[model samples]
Target: MFYKEIFSFIAIAITLAAFIPYIREIFRGTIRPHIFSWVIWGVTTLLIFVAQLEDHGGVGTWPIGVSASITIFIAYLAFIKRADVTITCGDWLFFIAALLSLPLWYWTSDPLWAVILLTAIDVAGFGPTVRKAYQFPYSESLLFFALFTLRNVLVMLALENLTLTTLLFPAVMLVLCILMMAMIAYRRRVLFA
Candidate 1:
């Protein structure tokens, strides 16, 4: 049980690690808006980690403390530093998907199936969500969401021991991400008049 929890935590950490560059870019903006969203996700990740540790027993929830601190910093970025970025339609969609997945995550006994369901909904919704975010020239937002969806897909693959057929989803997502970025870039240049 403990190892299972550790595996999940590590998977999530690896996913977050992949986005470090994007996160840095977001912060480096003149005003670091969107920190709230980042911090909220971070805290949720930490809580999941803590809950796992508790289930494992005797480990305590140190990771939660660290995550709380990170969230505080994020709050400071969002509130104190005045990084108030507007949320796009896609961002709201992603948020809604996450919320909708909560019950499925809790009620489902089969973790793999549950993850697959979550990933499916995310992939289905992602294209439109990303396209909407790109409307604001929020390329980083799109990339960030893409990375997130990639992370979830990867997690499902890893946890489920999916066969070759499982590769389809990620391949499709990669293509979509590329095409979306290209379209956005092209429009940015053409529409700047």
Candidate 2:
């Protein structure tokens, strides 16, 4: 129990550490996050937090709740600041797909199914960000994602229930963040080369 609390706190700290810089960069107009991605992540993350709580996620879910709030704020900022408003057809497809998935999750009876649906949507939500990052490699923050990857691991470790619903999102996000960082690095090198 003590270890869970500690892990949760540390994970929460890392969430703030990661997002603070990304938020700072957004205000500085250095990092232009995709609005679609943020909205999907924010909504799904919040829903996942709720699912985790019901599934006995304990203190670990706190960071996810915190992240969801921050993510929604970032989405608002992205919309208002007009950061990367270049919406392509594919971007619209991703956005639309995310919207469509919401109903599926909402109708889901099982927490696991809801988490799975939301998690998949959250992952697919990466489309616009990945697309944008590929085109403008330096526009995204590598360090933020690195911290996120670590945070997800801590989140998993902090989980009290250890159920599939409780662990799946962070587990998947852990992999996604690593892959995202790798893709960004490759894009940076290729573009710079």
Candidate 3:
């Protein structure tokens, strides 16, 4: 019980802290976010928040909920600032597909399947960001992604159910975060070298 509370608080704090620098950098015009990616993330995170609540009703899910809210705000900032915004046609297609999947998720009988579909869409949404990161790596904040990966780890530990439905999203996000971080680092090195 005590450990759960501790991990929950830590996860939420780290998740929020991770975004602070990213948001600050965005305002400072240091890190320019891919608007498509942020928009997709904002929507996907909100869906994941709903799925998490259904799969695991505990304090661990609070971080995801908070993250969803923050993601929306960041998306708004990205839209308004329009810094390094890259939105290809395919990116629009992916977003539409993801948005369309919400109905499919609602039509599904299994909660786990709904979560799985949402996670797949979320992963697919990363394509735009991955392409952007490959082209312009410095536009992203590596520290923010690193901290997010850590927060996901803590949130995973805090989960009470530990089922596939509950575990898959965060686990996938952790890997994606690490991949994005590595891509940014490698691209930065190659470009700057």
The model with the greatest lDDT is 2
Q: lDDT tens string, model 3, 5-110? A: 7898999999889999999999999888877777878887887788778876477777888899999999899889997656788778877887777677777777
Ranking, lDDT, top scorer first = 2, 3, 1
Tens-digit lDDT track of model 1 for 1-193: 3553454465456456644555475578632445435444444444343333433322223333344455456556666555545666666766576656655645655444443554455354444434443564554444554654555444434433233223333444456666656665666776686
Error of 1 at 9 (Å): 16
Tens digits of per-residue lDDT for model 2, 1-193: 8999999999999999999989999999999999999999999999999999988899989999999999999999999999988999999999999989898987888999999999999998999999999899898999999999999999999999998999999999999899889999999899879
Residue 39 of model 2, lDDT score: 92
Question: What TM-score goes with each of the models?
Answer: 0.46, 0.98, 0.94
How many pairs of residues in model 2 come into backbone collision?
A: 0
**Candidate 1, lDDT over the whole model:** 0.48
Off by over 4 Å in 3: none
Clashing pairs in 2: none
| C-alpha positional error of residue 1 in candidate 3 after TM-score superposition, expressed in Å | 1.7
lDDT of 3 at 27: 97
Better of 1 and 2 by TM-score: 2
